[model samples]
Target: MHKSIMIQGTMSNVGKSLLTAGLCRVFKQDGYKVAPFKSQNMALNSYITEEGLEMGRAQVMQAEACGIKPSVYMNPILLKPTTDVGSQVIVNGEVIGNMKAVEYFRYKKTLIPDIMKAYEKLTDEYDIVVLEGAGSPAEINLKQEDIVNMGLARMTKSPVLLVGDIDRGGVFAQLAGTLMLLTEEEKAIVKATVINKFRGDKEILKPGLTMLEDICSKPVAGVIPYVYLDIDDEDSLSERFVRRKEGGLVQIAVIRLPRISNFTDFNALESIEEVNLSYVTSPAQLQEADMVIIPGTKSTMSDLLWMRQNGLEAAIKKLADKGKIVMGICGGYQMLGDTLTDPYGVEASGSLAGMGLLPMDTVFEKEKVRTQVTGQVTSPVGHFKLLEGAAIEGYEIHMGTSSSKSGGISSFSRLEYGLAGKREVKQDGYIMDNILGTYVHGIFDSEEFLEGMVKTLLKSKGLNYEQVKTVDVKAHKEEQYDRLADTIRQNLDIEFIYKILEAGV
Candidate 1:
């Protein structure tokens, strides 16, 4: 039998994901096979598995901490929000359909069987499973059909650790009030409480911790200090968008679309020491950028209209006309074309004018393209020629196909996909002058592609590329995982956690 423990937060972004990942790493280092599980996740940031199935990035990150391959079973149900009220609901890595907030709430209960099936598969394979809960469980209105929090703990027979954010203040009230709100049966499932994101002295907060334990009648397992580690974030609530870094050899600006999905694609580029990346919301921030990247979005047409209304479309066109490097990926790639037609109303009902930087047209389709690809850079012209012949690999997740408006143009890359024993080769994206676009999401993750891009940008600016050192993103992430595990081992009570897992509720 597999032992289980769950981490539930007092509110969203309270370090629940990080703590769960840390526990996963601790268990792995202790010579036990481990896996991460989440019943349902609602986030725009997603990842494509090796099987070409989609799942949330948080579980992906936790799976990495466990030194395991990411699987759709890690995140059984993923909800990618397309608007304020409606979301694209995906079950077991395939799109079921779009649903409104109320509609999904009524329909989510029916997915319990699917969730259990996935969970049982992981339990059968691993010695330990670290589960994560979304949002707060204190919302009385949402507690009825809650398959992700106390309800999941009940279903899985897992012990719970309630986490409260001390950095946001009211840690005691958050933990105490949450327990007060839960039913007696639900409260029994919680074995301990955790205070996360704490700064300053722990001795000063000892009195409050003791009082909190008394009030909640649960042991205080840990008070984790605020530590900075470069890890993937969950969703739009990520602080990476608002942060600004000064002084770098190269400046890259990414357009911050309202419905941006998979912005984590740029994380590898941001890890470079000589590259300063900023998420720009307006034209003013794009002035000094050496390259402007339009990122992926959930709603291509609506976000493109937003760019048009805010004058970013005109500003990007002006930059491209001036011979500045402009690149687009996925939905951003769709926006660089001449026109976008959605006869099936996948995004919107009519045709919309694009930025017209590249000579291509896009048409949204009902079926989404999801796959993992490997390829090499094809023939190129101008400054981008530096990337020619470079090996590249990434995954594709989009709802439309783009093609040349006038016959055909030079492709940005030649892609190959493996199926059974045969290999299928196809061309992807288009390149024109200083503008290029591709549907590949993690195009820069490969060292050859990233180094080539940096060298190209540097050569364009009349600088020596050898002056800047390239980062090995894979090794850097491994170091970060170890650092996170070290912190958790030092601050949290691992022995107590083991006891909780063994004792259960």
Candidate 2:
């Protein structure tokens, strides 16, 4: 018999994704075949599966914790926001169309069938399905048509462990108020309340915990202490974008665009002991960097314009002219080109001049390319000759096609395999002068490519690459999952959680 439990947060960024992932690890460690499920996810950080399908990175992370291959069924619906009030809606890993906030809200309920189809697949295959909720079920306005929170819990018949952020304060109010807002039936689905990110002595907070339990009429599952784990965060709320990490041999400044998507691509670099990776939105931050990276974005044209208006484009161009290493990935790669033309209004209508750092020009098309590819560096290039012949593996998810204007630029990688078993060998990206650009999202995730790039960067600075310790990101992530499982086992009521899972709503 398959059992399930849901983790719903009192608010966004209240550690919902991590908690779900931790639980997945715990269940997997306990010898249960587990998988994560989120009926809907609204985040720009997405991943492409081996089947050439897209899903939220949070689900991908949780799937990793479960030691399972990520599937689109894990996240049936993904909303990639393109504007303040609009988003590109992806259903079952394919883009349906862009929808405004009101339009999506009205049309969301209609996708319930799709959500259930995905959920049933997981239930049939796994012993335990760890479901995650988006935001809070307390949003009374959205509760009526809600398909992600209480509604999803009811649909899947999964008991919930509602989590509150104690570190953010108002742990009592957050937990109690959320319970207060839920209908009696909805409240019944909540098996227990979890106080997440708790610091200070639990003994000192025992009285308050008792009071919270008394008021909410629910068990305090646990007070999870704030853990410092190097996990991939879901969205912009990531502390990685703001936290300062001191002391490193190399400094890489990533241009933080307004709609930065898949910034998690750089987490591998952060794992290296000698590398200091920082997200920079200003010109001042770029001054002392050994390398600058332009990451993927949901709005390429608009973000490029934002950089142009904010002087970041000028600063990066100035750095490039001085022979400094500059790199671009996906949308960032498109921005590095000479021009960006949007004929179908995929991003925005009309053509916009790019950063003019590369000889390529990108034109937005109606079709989005989503595929997994493996390749190797092409011709050896100046400064980064160390990257020559390095193996690379990643995925491409973009709505544009880029080509060299003069056809004089050298190719970066010779990629093999495309969407749906299409056996095609094609050159991807470019390597020219001091610039590098690629549509591959996880370009640095390949340890071979990553180590080679790091060595090249250190070599350019006259530093010994052999002296520095590089990270095996894949192995490191497994260690982190174990660490997270240990932490959860120590703090959370795992026995009770298992009972809750078995008890089914």
Candidate 3:
């Protein structure tokens, strides 16, 4: 008796993904085995599952909320947008080829059986399945062939809970307009409407809520207040990165590029009480920080160009010249080198000059290097020493290999799955002393390495340090899931949701 509910947004960035995760956590706390499902997701941010399959980072985050390893079945179809009108279609974690918007719309309907199969598999194993819908079901132009929203609801006969963002304003119209456009059958499946991201007093929304229920004949489930939980957002509209408070202790500036990826790497740092984290957008902003970090990027060349355009290139050069500590991860690591040669046109507009902080070069290859590795740091840097022989684990998802001539630098350490052998060190790759660049994402998850870096940076500034340690990363995340679940449970209509799941409407 697996009960399910689908949370669909009135529009994109309406907090559907977060809501889905919250519901999954809530149901799980209520003694129900719960999982999250999405029929299709489109984003460049992706994760490689344990089975070596790829899926959207949204479902990956949702899966994290459920305290489970991510699976390709959780997100059966993923579209990584490569161009304005086309995307690289990944079906069941394998690339099928690039397809235009119109082509994908027509092709998506054919995959319904596969989606249903995955859904059925989850239903059999879990007591509850919370499905998240992408974008909106009110796109009348695209409704005829929709498979992500109303169409998926019809397919599973699942009750729908439409969520609207009140913080963005005109939420009433957003919900009212969407309901007005829904087909009779589509409208019938919607059991309740929940207003999300509401700030200020909930009493002020009473009239608006009454009007919405009167017009749509749907009950107002709850008005979710804005909760500033320190969690990762799956998409580009990540408020977690931007909503950070200023700390009076160690100041670290993160260069906010136009196409920043893997920005979630800084979440652990944000949790530290003694660290002040800010996203530096201008050269003037860079001058106030003790250390600077360049995060990963989707298009290294394009982001590099953007850096130059914003005068950040000059700022980075000045910071390095002043002997300030700087670090780069993945594409950010690629950008810290002398030159990046993309002779194969792998990352847009050919080769380009790097920030030149390290004497290394990166060459983009046709194939991507994807793997999960656990190892120790062998470099002379104190941060590396702290991480020496310390069990470290993270995944690598990139399309290039780095080479450096600097002695005492490990080309690749701790080879694990997807890494067949030791990586060769050339005249150019990973360099040490005042700089560290690696293709590994999630490196900050290593407690010894992260805390040490923060302490070292603080000590470099002649400032007193405080040791802040995170207990069990996995447990901390599960606790977050429980908190999110509690929030939804306290606000939403639990009886109605249970009835919908029981009735299979």
Clashes of each: 0, 0, 7
Q: Model 1: per-residue lDDT, tens digit, 1-505?
A: 8999999999999999999999999999999999999999999888888787999999999999999999999999999998899999999999999999999999999999999999999999999999999999898999999999999999999999999999999989999999999999999999999999999999999999888888899999999999989888888888889877776788999999999999989988888877899999898998998899999999999999999999898888888888889999999999999999999989888999998888889989989988889998897777788888988888889999888967654587899864435668889988877898998888888878898888888888888887666677778888999999999999999999999999987
Model with the higher lDDT, candidate 1 or 2: 2
**Candidate 3 Cα errors over 4 Å, as ranges:** 99-103, 382-387, 406-415, 419-429
Ranking by lDDT: 2, 1, 3
What is the Cα-based lDDT of residue 233 in candidate 3? 75
> Against the true structure, candidate 3 has what lDDT?
0.79
How do all models score by TM-score?
A: 0.98, 0.98, 0.92
Considering summed lDDT, which 10 consecutive residues are worst modelled in model 3?
A: 422-431
* RMSD score of candidate 2 (Å): 1.1
Clashes of 2: 0
Error of 2 at 195 (Å): 0.6
Ranking by TM-score: 2, 1, 3
For each candidate in the order shown, give its overall lDDT on alpha carbons. Answer: 0.91, 0.92, 0.79
Stretches of candidate 2 above 4 Å error? Answer: 419-421
lDDT of 3 by residue, 168-191 (tens): 999999999999999899889998
Model 1 residue 101 lDDT score: 97
